[model samples]
Target: MITTVQRPTPADWDSWYTAGWPAVVTDKESESFHRTVQPYPGMTAVDLACGNGQWMRQLTAWGVFVTGYDFSTEALRQARAAGLPDGLSYAQWDIDAEPIPPALMPGSLDLVTCRHALPYLEYARVLTDVGRWLKPSGIFYALVRVADDQDNATAQSDSVLESFHRGFTEAQIDGIGIGWARRTTYRLSARNCGIVLRGYGDSDCQPCDVSS
Candidate 1:
């Protein structure tokens, strides 16, 4: 029989981050992205479910206008406390909701980065919205959970972690990147079973590489 996992509230998430919970994506992941992405000044981007706004700070430092979205009050508080310079902003929203906010309009962004947060939301719906929100030449960056990973075991048990509810497949990623210009995917972990999806809108799409 299938069991239900309770979702964590904003306060719970805040406490988790405050406790210095380590993030899955570190220098290696960011290096991979920076190597692939060519960020220009005035570029508009969004960090979906941005925790503590580290990625947003990086983008802002690179002169990209960044908007961060998250529901955790404490996380946002930390981000604000960092004293964001111009070109950075934040919004609070439950990403699982049916319609995304109007601020994330269709074809308006140059990039959208989502890390370790896809499982909590309806994966397909969020993917579709990300695609629509991207400009014709925009890029989508994501680190998503897969069903085959041991991390998914929580999905079989009663857990409050979002990973328990989120998983992905190559076919689903393909379906989401229908019109992407270039697509590169890599596996990040052996034990966790996660994949990094890098989809560009202006370049020619390439074959999916699962070997990583």
Candidate 2:
């Protein structure tokens, strides 16, 4: 299990949201997302730590049914105030404090995504739950900051360094042991990266055709 020594509480995130921290999708993140996920009409998806519902909105735009989960009430409020699309919904759930929701049945989900929040989550447990919840052809996608010597050297504060210390190494990701049939990792930037994992039952292990 990936242990997190320190993580932001819901109140901290509420304050951040109140201070206008938008869930801005950067160009690199967009590129990585498009490359990693292919949503079809009627597909079911869940976005973890789905601040402000940016990803849920995007997936719904592509005709997918999306349920966004977040711990911050303020973030969910902002997300709802933005207007939910036909197939989009939001729920408040503190992943660290709670077990996986009973609504997420085994083999029920087509896709699962976590962006910019994996370092704060119990990722091993999350991965196991994702593996159980996903359909045979489902994918688990994650975007996270990378921990490296450069990041450590450039960290602005003790808190920043602590967060960086929680970030994953490429080797760490490879050793996560979710028994995926296929796993692909790619860099989004010098300090950020993404991964795509398919379950053991997924026979179509070929990479997505999208350009890197």
Candidate 3:
């Protein structure tokens, strides 16, 4: 079972970004994104908690128009300073505090992504919103740290313990997706996992699947 820990505040994120924290995308993450999302030139995507906009940049490179949201002003500032493409934009929005933006009309987006930030948000509500925001063929992708049984025994410091607390167990992750009528797939890595949720109306939607 995963234990609860104090969540990081927006101030904590601002401090980290101000300290020059790097946004690193792993090979597994890139591969999983490409394999699952299969972006096309005209696809539109929304990235939630898009710190530094690294994923936004990647998606834009594949010719997808992306709108990114982050809670930390400093993070959004750095992302903008890094330069935005013609089809990409960033906004400072706190997911926990605000309702889904009115601009994101029902069934308008092709993809919605929440990476490394799902554990911090009210994810059930987020999932429901994403379901409504996406087109019939749209997908919701999330990458999150997974809690392990060995975490408590192997953790070397308070930071490690805090990280453990922030993770969701495989069961917890599975349970969340099951509550909504959608196809759910899991792509597991050593310390993290990727989840893809497709609306039930989608032709390719299935009950569940697990892949490497």
Candidate 4:
């Protein structure tokens, strides 16, 4: 059965093993991912399913106007309590709901990062949505749970990719690799996690850049 996406409050979510944040297994090894999405001074980026706004906080520091969205009120409250910079903002939205308008900010946002959260939804549809939300030349950075060389049996059981696709499709895509290579980027595990696929999307069909 497909589980419905929910935005639980910190109060209610705390009753579980972990509270209201968009985190995967509370593994000590899962490092905090910082999307190195180079944008202009006034670029806008959205952190979808932002757990505790860790990267959200960093993005704002990098001069990108960051907007974080999650269903967890506790997470949102914590983000607010953290006293973010002037350009930082937060909103609540259920991930299971399809085509949510308010959450989809259209062409205004320059980048959208959905780290450690893609396995929970329909990958194709979610990709389509990200494509819709981005500006003509925007970026979508994601970290999906996959069977990349970093898997233990226990970890695999809880993988979001396992929860969705029976198997996974691993690709190193970039702007030049896809139909619209000059306008897209696909950097798989370029930064932190060894298995994570990092994508830098432009207004293209999603490919990779070989020169970089």
Candidate 5:
């Protein structure tokens, strides 16, 4: 049985991107997230932990000014090599160790997207900070990998490898819901173990109650 596998460190992530991650989401799945945001011209968005700039490319294509941030240098290198268009830029940051960069001003972002990347760090804290950075009408769109009771252990075999921690629970998702003006969730397929969460931020909502 698989047991006692260590969580991925920054260096592990660097190598993961170097070797490449085989992203398995469908076009419909990606379109679902895009449809939820409906990002328009002149909108500013940040894609936290953007691995290889997929979302950034989509958002920029929709005329959104987008910044893709990732801690892994190799990931950023790969993203930059993709020939990012105008209205798109990238920054290297260790989200768990630092505050959101000052350039990404509070209440100035139209959207913030984190796709399949939150489980590698302190997601709760990251979500709270993301809530604070958004504009009143902004949306926090995340495709998160939720934890399950199955075996996700890493081994030295030729099987498919998973990089993140176990996953998040329902309570954690609900805790995120409490802070938004409105929140909607769509569960992905069994292969992903993910949920597409879109949280709208407006003036009337309370701060995220993460204490639970």
Candidate 6:
């Protein structure tokens, strides 16, 4: 069992949402997210930590069966106001505190997208959870950045491994992408903002098994 570093309570999280963090679900992120998703008309997907349901709207527009989950009521309200497509659904959720519920079955999803959400989670726990939820061929997509990944553990802890995100290898880790996921990365053109994606098998995927 992987244990994630503890974080601010739900109240703190609620406060962040109330301050309008999920206010904008822009086109670039949306397009990047869209590229990661292999949606079909009836394909089932889960958008974890779906702030303002940006991916939900985009996926639904492509004819995917998108269901969104998040921890904040205010964000969910913003999601509702985002004009959800007819094929989309939503539920309130906190992935850190609880396991994926029955409504979100393991190995049942075709895709899972998490944009700007991982910085708030314990990286290892989040990765394993996503692996569990994905089916044999299911794809997992997330947008993580250096800016949103700060925590107090780094300020006081002496462990170098723990101080930095062990998973981040100079802003590249598990991802098999070309472009950087950090906030400061600049793009020469619109198309230059693309990803350097790698493919991993199902939960049983071994480290050397990644094909892309």
Candidates' C-alpha lDDT: 0.70, 0.75, 0.76, 0.53, 0.68, 0.57
TM-score for each predicted model, relative to the true structure: 0.78, 0.84, 0.85, 0.62, 0.80, 0.67
**Per-residue CA lDDT of candidate 1, range 1-212, in tens?**
12233557777787777887736456766666676676779999999999888878888877999999999888888888888799999988879753588898888999888876766666666777787788876777777655644545655455545433555544444454544545566655643333334554435677655435
Model 4 clash tally, residue pairs: 14
Off by over 4 Å in 1: 1-6, 22-25, 145-150, 161-181, 188-211
State the lDDT of candidate 2 residue by residue for 19-61, as single tens digits.
Answer: 8855477777776667666667898999999998877787787
Please list the residue runs of candidate 2 whose C-alpha ends up more than 4 Å from where it truly belongs after superposition.
149-166, 200-212
lDDT of 2 at 180: 73
State in Å the error of residue 91, model 2: 0.6
Candidate 3 lDDT tens digits, 1-212: 23444556688788778877644777778877798768889899999999998888988988999999998988999999999888999988889787767778999999999887776677777787888888987888888877755653343235622432355667777775654446445555666788887773454445676566
Candidate with better lDDT, 4 vs 5: 5
Q: Candidate 4's C-alpha lDDT?
A: 0.53
lDDT of 6 by residue, 1-212 (tens): 22254454556556666666443556766655555444678877888888777668878888888889887777788789868667797888888777667876667777777765554566555666655566756666655443222433462256533432312222333343222121123232322222222233323333322211
Give the winner by lDDT: 5 or 6.
5
For candidate 4, report its TM-score: 0.62
The candidate scoring highest on TM-score is: 3
For model 5, how does the per-residue alpha-carbon lDDT over 60-92 read when each residue is reduced to its tens digit?
877999998988888888889988799999999
| Candidate 3 whole-model C-alpha lDDT, 0 to 1 | 0.76
Comparing 1 and 2 on TM-score, the stronger one: 2
Please list the residue runs of candidate 3 whose C-alpha ends up more than 4 Å from where it truly belongs after superposition.
1-5, 149-165, 179-188, 200-205
lDDT for residue 176 in candidate 4, whole number 0-100? 13
Put down candidate 4 lDDT per residue, 1-212, tens digits, no spaces. Answer: 22233222334433321433234322222223233344556888888878667767767766889888877676677778878788999888766674475756667667887766564555555666666677776776665544442432333455443332222334422111232233322234433222222232444433433321
Rank by TM-score, highest first.
Answer: 3, 2, 5, 1, 6, 4
